[model samples]
Target: MDHAPRAPRRPAAPGSPPGGDERVRGAHPHAEPGAESDPDRAGGFPRPRRLPERQTVRDQVLGALRGALLSGELCPGAVYSAPALAERFGVSATPVREAMQLLAREGAVEAMPNKGFRVAERSSRDMAELAEVRALLEVPVVLRMARTLPAARWEQLRPLADATVAAAAQGDRAVYAESDRAFHRALLELSGNRQLVAVADELHRRAQWPVTEDHGCARPGAAPARGTSARLVTDATQHAALLEALAGGDLAAVESLVRGHVCGT
Candidate 1:
């Protein structure tokens, strides 16, 4: 009796390594142990990974919303519903609402009755006033630190300052804002005043609110328009200069740089 012919083997997927059995096994031969296998990897249609639930989702959504706000993707004075934002983020509405509530507390957005949260619309006067307040609070403290903070301590902050410059060069407003804030916070921490650092950080966040076309402020003696890549790079480079001033104990330069950095002068 003649035996039935053996079935032909399935062909290897395109881009697969020669002699590899990844298509049959549903995973790469060199894949990490315990890594999830993609059933459709050979077809180039890998499934999307689900976000973690609860606090992780809430924190991630909050960070994403904050980035959007800083990058001007979430426009000022516009309302965004929690359900809509949740859909956009591929998360449940519960976490989106929680994140929006936190933003409301931070004064980044305000809740509307029976509606969604509205992005805070801060005027030019508001930004100028916040900047003046920040200058009043920060300049003197930084000047004091300049005289006493050790060079090594100031040197430690160079990375944060460099991060701001890199972010500015890339024109990523969100990353630049965060790096700038981290640099200032690290600088102020040398003053040994936790309360001052906290207050100054809040002021910095408020001052960073995106200004609409009708409410823009031009920096004194700066040729580039506000929020432009040139303006951001100019602002970012000051962090390194300020660190150098602090390290060298140049009180006048420290004071002037701090004031100009905060007040946009």
Candidate 2:
């Protein structure tokens, strides 16, 4: 049978990395057809889209890595090489290495020389300890802020709290984690203590480590188990309740809600 001649390939644009666009578009071999066209459907370490001009490739990879962690795509205690992740993300290894290094510094992963980065594992006790510490630091500060922070300031935080609820409703764990942290960080920032904010942020990141089964096994690429979505929505709803309690000067309600929210009581 006769065949048509193949068209000549166009040269990459000046200053553009070779195969840059194609790599990003072609990375998702398993994605459903037309999934890339809709950002909402591009779950779990999605290909980088056009971001703000200021966002670097490393930043993009870091964000995706965090999302992967939250979604349990990068299971706890598993080692992953930067080059492998680079190919998965359709980016160069340099950005993935830099991003992994940043994650290592953030305590999310540990560098394994001549191997790869291992996702940090947390025991049940470790989670409890983190929760206790968070409660100790955040509950008191939030209570104080409730009394002194202006009503308008509390109102300003409404949008952030709502963002968490929105993310939860969408059943996107990664998005919920980011919005959840944003809500807490914004609330803490009202305390006007940069150091406290920094510490609390780190603790929050640690608290969000992907949970493992009782036998220390991780379910990779699994959907949230039964009741997980409901729990997320319930937890996210508390953000609004917290703001209301704080704004109403209900110290008792604020204490209860903040403790439950922080410690997962």
Candidate 3:
């Protein structure tokens, strides 16, 4: 299906931006500095409540849980209870249960008959399917962007590219994952397809969830390779090269690199 034309995406000029949802949770295992937590206060990586009206307890619980999943605080096999998560976040079990159900719907968590919930486990086939979907959705959009989007727009993504490199160098999985996500998102947003962005984000998140076992990248697991820190450094370099290809309007190179990145990463 063909779409109407719109302005190409303009990446941030230089400085770093928030690492998507990671920034929302503050991404640290501990609470933010000076942030207070009480059993009744309801906190744990939740976004700040606005003054006039605070976020609903359910939203707060959801945000914190999502952050936990992304930050590796919640592992694939870890089983957790609503009451326990509620106590830890200082929220009510009602909200925690509601949030867990939501995550379950997204396949981020699973419900046990007696146990509350466990992080969802992915098989090698599961990860492969996610990568295949991501490639189908993202590669074409990026190819179009490369051919039509102005070169200046691509230059704005330099900071995100740099952040990916730094995060890989530092071996910070959370940072690397989020930075890589951000870079791809920035590219897709240029295509002005909201549905595409939403679907791509879902696949990206699933692909990123860490597996408890050591699974080869080519097999079915998609969390960066087992010794992925070094691999991430190599991948980060490839991101820089991809940006150069996009800027140069090399359609063939853009498509080739995007395929390798979406499928192989």
Q: Which of the numbered candidates is closest to the native, going by highest lDDT? A: 2
lDDT tens digits by residue: candidate 1, 82-173: 99899889999999999999989888999998899998988788889998899888887777777776889989988899899888987767
Model 1 ranges off by over 4 Å: 1-55, 214-227
Report residue 80 deviation for candidate 1 (angstroms): 1.0
lDDT of 3 by residue, 158-239 (tens): 8899989998886756667778889888877888988988888878877876554643322223333333678779988888
lDDT of 2 by residue, 17-129 (tens): 66744445344656666676777666334566786679899999999998887776787788999889999899999999999999998788999998889988867888889
Specify the poorest-scoring 10-residue window by lDDT in model 1: 217-226
RMSD of 2: 18.1
Best by TM-score: 2
Candidate 1 residue-wise lDDT at 214: 47
lDDT of every predicted structure (CA atoms): 0.81, 0.83, 0.77
TM-score of each: 0.73, 0.74, 0.68
Please report the TM-score between candidate 3 and the true structure. 0.68
Candidate 2 vs candidate 3: the lDDT winner is 2
Q: Over all chains combined, what TM-score does candidate 2 have? A: 0.74
Q: Rank the candidates by TM-score, best first.
A: 2, 1, 3
Clashing pairs in 1: none
